[model samples]
Target: MTIDTLDIAASPMPATVPKRSFLQEVIEDTPGSDPRFEMCIQCGTCGGSCPSGPDMEYSPRRIFAMIKADMREEVLKSNTFWYCVSCYYCMARCPQQVHITDLMYTLKRKAVREGYCRKSTASDAPDFSEFFADAVLKYGRSFELGLATRYHLRHHPLGAIKMATGMGLEMMRKGRMDLTPRRIKNVDQLQAILSKAEEIARQEREQGGVA
Candidate 1:
């Protein structure tokens, strides 16, 4: 659906509605707070660079337009956020110096907040995104295999059993996966940083409600 299909007006600042665009908040929340959207010259450079553009419901260019139009709900609910592979092609090719990858990540954070995420199935582990976030929050580093196993156990108990049966013997033989997580020496410091960052983001989100 196009941004015009929505009842929202196409304006940077919506005077009638006390609403915040998801795009605007994303731009604001990113580290260094790059004005990625501000520099778009409508050259379609980002769209050309995006490998997944053809499959997307809205191209990167369209998303930018929608964001500028303050179509917050549409942007958040769309599958466009999940489709980004973080390739950074758009970021690298952008003539305007827009941090496209960072914007994609911001949209992902919004997707999580809006409960737009897909649940794990019987054969699948929990969302790797959640596990990744947890790892960052807890250890300030990613423990990929550990997080994957934990995610599987937490979200797909049956799958975990199957996985263990299938790979447990091999893992034991090779000593590839560890049951216990290796702790970082300065975990508290890492947690503190993550906690503060999360708090700031939460505040920004609260301030910038759906438009």
Candidate 2:
């Protein structure tokens, strides 16, 4: 499928500012990453497939175009990644197998790492993602109760107590909550793996000349 192109040079922007692009970053970090960005036909399949597309500032198709256009600030500030539900419908429906969902995840990581998430109204999403990652790295699995308590205490103290009071006992009675976290038997090995992954990522960023 062929996609029509627009001349970005005609867009209203200062000529002195060099255009920035992160398509390579997306391909490097996204799971099931693919570099065949040109395969996108602008058919709206991914946008239509997304359940939360309507709530996003830019749909997946438009985000792809922005990426190609090197609209880094706009794309990074967009709520597109936060709105993704990981349903995989977009990826499943894409004729080009573009891995749209994974790309969204990658964009979310980039937004957080580069501090773009601080300017977004959807800061909670990145905060939750970071909290979840920390939890997994520490416990090998999400410690639900601990995570909830920690998150609320840091982000919403008043609401935290209220929410816990309302549902905590009920959840415990139903055996839905555990006060203690269960640690995996091979936690040390998992930590080693994570450390190695981080080391590799640090090396890649250095090699790519990106801070």
Best candidate, lDDT-wise? 2
Q: Tens digit of lDDT per residue, candidate 2, span 1-87?
A: 333476677878787745334675566666543546667888899998889999999999999988877788889888899989899
- Candidate 1 Cα misplacement greater than 4 A, ranges: 1-23, 118-126, 150-176, 200-211
Q: After superposition, how far is residue 24 of candidate 2 from its true place, in Å?
A: 3.1
What is candidate 1's lDDT per residue for 55-157, written digit by digit as tens? 6778888888888887876776666657778898988889888887787777766666665544311112126777877877776677766776778888778
Worst lDDT 10-window in candidate 2: 17-26
Question: Mind sharing the TM-score for model 1?
Answer: 0.68
Question: TM-score for every candidate vs. truth?
Answer: 0.68, 0.83
Q: Candidate 1, residue 103: CA error in Å?
A: 1.0
Clashes of each: 0, 0
In terms of TM-score, the best-performing candidate is 2
